[model samples]
Target: PYHSVAACAGLLRAGGFTELADGAQWKLARGGKYFVSKGGSEIMAFIVGGRFCQPGVESGLSIVGAHTDSPCLRLRPNSKVSGAGMLQVGIQTYGGGLWHTWFDRPLGLAGKVVVREAAPGRPDETRLAEKLVRITDPLMILPNLAIHLQSAEERKAFAVNPETHLQPVLCSKMFDDEAGKEASRPEDAGDARHHAALLEVVAKRLGCAPGDIMDADLCLMDSMPACLAGLYEEFISSPRIDNLLSTWAAVQGLCDFAASSAVADCQDVCIAVSFDHEECGSQSTCGADSNSMSVWLESLLGALEVPPLARPLVYAKSFLLSADCAHGVHPNYAAKHQSEHRPDFHKGIVIKTNANQRYATTALTSALFREVCKKADVPVQDFVVRNDSPCGTTIGPIVSSKLGIRTIDIGAPQWAMHSCRETCASSDARHLRALCGAFFESFRNIDTAAAKM
Candidate 1:
């Protein structure tokens, strides 16, 4: 479960994308690829249209979006707490997840840490540092209450209090000597000395003084790495599969298109954007609700020397594919899904729809995606929640409304959505990559067809 935004930036850089700073002037080449990040969590990448500089033909944008965030336990600023002669780390749940599943799992910490950097002549400045600290030797566990101690009713209805039951015990009585030593350091006074041992471990790993650590946005993730599961090894069992799968698929698709000669000869710009905080509402500056995409588009057009009046025409012709994870019908709980609309694993990509606009897929846009899948020889499925069940949303509708561009919501089907571990078919992941590649390669023809209709 790799969750760091800085990590995503590294991958994009390796994929031949030149990073652009805010308000930086850049020249766009025919078939040029570039990317920009907001708060290092949300990222957007673009490929210039091959025919963008042609005389009279208008170029359209083919954009794909996914999110990189997942539900996990985040440590607070003052996270150290001692109880029952044991040192524990205080944690707050970040998003809605299967909390009980997190119990008794080998967890590791990963996220960016903010540190104070002081140079000789310059003023003190704060910088962000990232690290993936693994305490995988089973350092902490939220032990479950014994079943023998619970009533029959209580046993049937399992509940966990995040404030009380979720704290992870790191060690017992071993930190006393470290705490005493920390007390002698001037910067480690008061509550800071409480978790001196833990800070010392992190400081050592980061190669920084303990006092330079200002704060962190650390999250506890399952220590287990992604691997194939099932009798025939047909399923992928991993953490953050709900969205990281989509992010990976989108990146693979864009890279495939960029390497193809067909894409280099085309006139449509292709993009893949992965945002953070979609697990929570996307209200941050880097979120879909923000003007990050819009501003970037305008800048690109300006660099291409497109007239201001022609920008709206370019947007009107643009299309966005919002890829996220879709729920697969569980074998044991098939009845929980809509009777006729249950999406199955390994079948194909799922097209999500909601009349209430929870999903942005309309008849035209959904058909556009289906046509793309058909061209790629990929199977397609449909998913709509049961009438009695509440619908979940994605960045589809948010980006659609924000840019007023035609959009469709789609994803690879998966099981155990918010669990510490989730399941999906490896075949479906491959199919999504092909589908997105076909979309980026053939979107120009699709746009012309849709325009005629």
Candidate 2:
């Protein structure tokens, strides 16, 4: 999540965008590009339209939204536990994840850590710090029980109790001997002391004293880097691909749009945003459901000397594309998807729709997106869950309802969405990027087309 924010900020900086203060107001110039971050997890970068600076000239916004957070095992406070001569880290499943896929997988830690910073004026000064700590060559693993230990019925309906089975082993008795009996202390054998030991490890990783580490929000992630797969290298398998793929594509599209010569001709303000906490019902301050996006847009218009009353007019003309990942039909589980709406890998981007507002894709917005994809020379697919199954949602509905903007839900097709590892076609990723770029570049045209219809 931190990487996505940092990467987008880096791209904006490299593209000559000045980073704006969180709530500070400043006048914007025509074609000026600026970015502001909320809670360091949600970021918005915009390129001003040519006519946006003019008074009484209503310019629309072309926006793309995605989320950074993914389903994973989040380490809790006082999380260390010991049993059967092995030290483990206690974890709570953060979202609806395929818990079984995490078994025996190599895991590493990454997240923000709060610490004390020495300040001259404020003796009680404290600030949060970010760190990615890899404890060992093979940091942790949740080993699966042997198949022979289970009955045929049990094997067929295997279910793990996360509280009992998901604890990741951090160390074993063999490692204690290698450390010269350091784990032999009676106090060290206790849970509290085990937690202290874990803190000490974190301190070492941060090059600070244990007491200096105030708190942390670390999560376990697959240690393996994303890479191309398949004999012909047609697939890209990686952790956090569900939404990161969309996040990456949106960032690339924004950067490309900002750098392109087409900005001068574009009549709509192009904005790209990636929020955190979509996995857990977007209720946080930085989530899509929050007022961050609305506040930023209002602030930008205020800085541009536009009257508060006209802001609603601007928003009414805006269009949003909520980009997330869509489930591709698994060959083995084909019955789970609506037969006519089965999305395929490498086929193109998918336009997601739900009769119930689980997705924000309306007929008008979907048509607009289809036109955008048509112009980009990218094919598009449709997705709808089977009648018996419930559909998972994205930031689409939240943002659309929160801001009252015309929105469409779209994403690249992928398999094993919430698994520790997911797969998507490399070509589909490229196609999505092309589609987003076209969406930003031609959304104004699409809006006009929508009006004519």
Candidate 3:
């Protein structure tokens, strides 16, 4: 939703930054101070620099990166179909989502709409902002096959069909034959009329013309609000916690690092990036693989007038912390993880590594992170993918390759990473915050000579 972006933008603005909107681009920068950007969720990044630089020396940059987008069902452009005399919204799986998890739950729709806004001279250059629409009432439910329909064997052996098993009922409108009769002509009626009717309702709420809307990237979200759950209420049970947990930690760390640096005279820049589309792939413009972060960094360096040759020196001595959510060993699926490699809830930060380089964590990077953690008295842990099991990669490798900086991947332990409602230990959230803060603080103090070696 637009509100979420606004909330994040508010944080950046409050931290002393002037906001800029260049068409669809949303950038917030402090006058010779800090910077943050929402590259339309495919990526989001922020830079904190402009104070604490040696005279005639641009500050070295310390970067933290994460992804903003999560796995969910996306409504296709022509997502209208009729079944059993009722209308349903057609959809396809957006990422590697657990299909069964989406059945029979109350779902809401929210996203951005590319609409034709009032502009002078160039109507083609229409402005863009997020348009969030929610179907608050339970108008749709994906009813699972009844036990009668599925033989005992079939019930246990059935796999979901994205086309058939995931259709969402559009409520009474689907069965309103009298209304359908009044709106049945394709030229004069039918699904188009129905859709138009629905749009009228949506347009009324948005206060815009239906024809003004060009395209949409709508998401079906669980209607449930985030809350504290568990027998002792010691854990956070929320939607999108897999990466949100790390994201919140990263933001907190940047805030803490900036506040701490208020009086220090250090020649280093600190940044926190939360990119989008990581759940699917980091290929979008807002993704870590894209040039969004690079563009911002280069601009800052240019503004600071750093020599091109010295840029490599800054990177060689620089460090990037890739914050993502790591799997905590599940009690039910304990065998899925190696005994020693399994991370515990609220234990400490998890250092994710892959021999195949799926992760950016290497011996050298881990060693540096360990040093920072040690100096801050922060506890740390390690995680390696089970040899036979495929591992999920993060933005760590992408940024490392793009900027040639030493990158380390870290996350808090959590359950149900891609579920609508995910869970994480409350203590782990706070622990990750402390760990990231320490890294941001210590990164500026590391001896460049020693770090390079």
CA shift of 16, model 2, Å: 2.3
Candidate 3, residues 85-139: lDDT per residue as tens digits?
7667778787777778877788777666665576667776766545656555555
lDDT of 2 by residue, 283-384 (tens): 999998888888888888878777788778788889889999999999999988998999998899999999999999998888888889999999999999
Q: How far is candidate 1 from the true structure (C-alpha RMSD, Å)?
A: 2.5
- RMSD (CA, Å), candidate 3 to true, equals 3.6
- Give the alpha carbon lDDT tens digit for every residue of 188-268 in model 1: 364383377777767777778777777777788788788998999999999998798888778778877877888567877
Clashes per candidate, residues 3 or more apart or on different chains: 0, 0, 6
- TM-scores for all candidates? 0.93, 0.92, 0.88
- By TM-score rank, best first, the candidates go 1, 2, 3
Q: Could you say which candidate leads in lDDT?
A: 2
- Full-model lDDT, candidate 3: 0.70
For model 2, the local distance difference test gives 0.83
Q: TM-score winner between 2 and 3, please give it.
A: 2
Candidate number that wins on lDDT, 1 or 3:
1
